[model samples]
Target: MVLNKIEQLLEKYENAETTLQEEQELKTYFSQDQIAPHLEVYRPLFAYYKASKHETFTKDIPLKTKNTNVYKWLTVAAVGVLMLGFYFNTSKHITTTDDDLGTIQDPELAYNEVVNTLELISKTLNKGTATVGYLQTYNQGIATVNYIHELEHTSNIIFKNNK
Candidate 1:
């Protein structure tokens, strides 16, 4: 009768309808030495299942150390310092005077001087304008000119109102 129950449980196990308790019972029955000769073929399968229940196939994976590129960061800092130094030097040179403050006294001359001074400032501040392609070069120059014109118009409006 126990052999018949074992055979039924094995059938349930094969059909994947056996509960965990039923599976454990099947394993228990097959693990004994008194199993029927006909069911002896299933002993190894049950042993594998029983062994797998307590056998852990999991492993603790060691984490890899992340490497940082400190030299790249150093290079970026060096470039930033160089850019700041260049900016300060160029700004000083562009604004420096030769003790002739009244030389640009005429408004028209002042306006042209302003435009030339702005162009020099833009050249110093915006070094990327030199490398722009022919297609974008006109647009970039136009944008700068428009910005300067807007500033000049605003200043003229303020000066006329004050006068």
Candidate 2:
């Protein structure tokens, strides 16, 4: 009689049609070592469910408060002190200087360097204009491809309408 009821319950459980009360009865029966020999395979599954049902994380987690503003203020104060020290140390060097800053000592050398820089800039501009001319060719090719795709699209539409 016991095995017959267990078989019926097992069928209902497999079909997910068993009620909570019937499920609890099945759990109670399977958790014991006195279960029938053939039903012993189901005991570990029920034991695992019973064991995991009571498990939970019980420790308290620490919460963050609004005391982070103190660290922000300290960081701002440290940066301000560093900037003030840098300004005072640099001001001494500026006040001690007697000659004009970065003035060219040799005028002919400065003029030669400027002329060489202008020549380099002119060469780079020529290279850029050559590349831009190639882009014109690329644009023409793209236009030709777009015309082909337009013809293909029209033919596809005509074929679809004929069907």
Lowest summed lDDT window (length 10), candidate 2: 96-105
lDDT tens readout by residue for model 2, 1-67: 9889988998898899999999998998897668888888888888998999899999988786767
lDDT of 2 at 21: 93
Q: Summarize candidate 1's per-residue lDDT along 67-106 as a digit string, tens digits.
A: 5578779999999999999999999878978685567667
lDDT of 2 at 155: 100
TM-score for candidate 2, residues paired by index = 0.36
Could you report the Cα RMSD, in angstroms, for every candidate shown? Answer: 22.4, 14.8
lDDT (CA) for every model shown? 0.87, 0.90
Estimate the overall C-alpha local distance difference test score of candidate 2: 0.90
Which portions of model 1 show Cα errors greater than 4 Å? 53-60, 65-163
Given candidate 1, what's the lDDT at residue 8?
Answer: 89
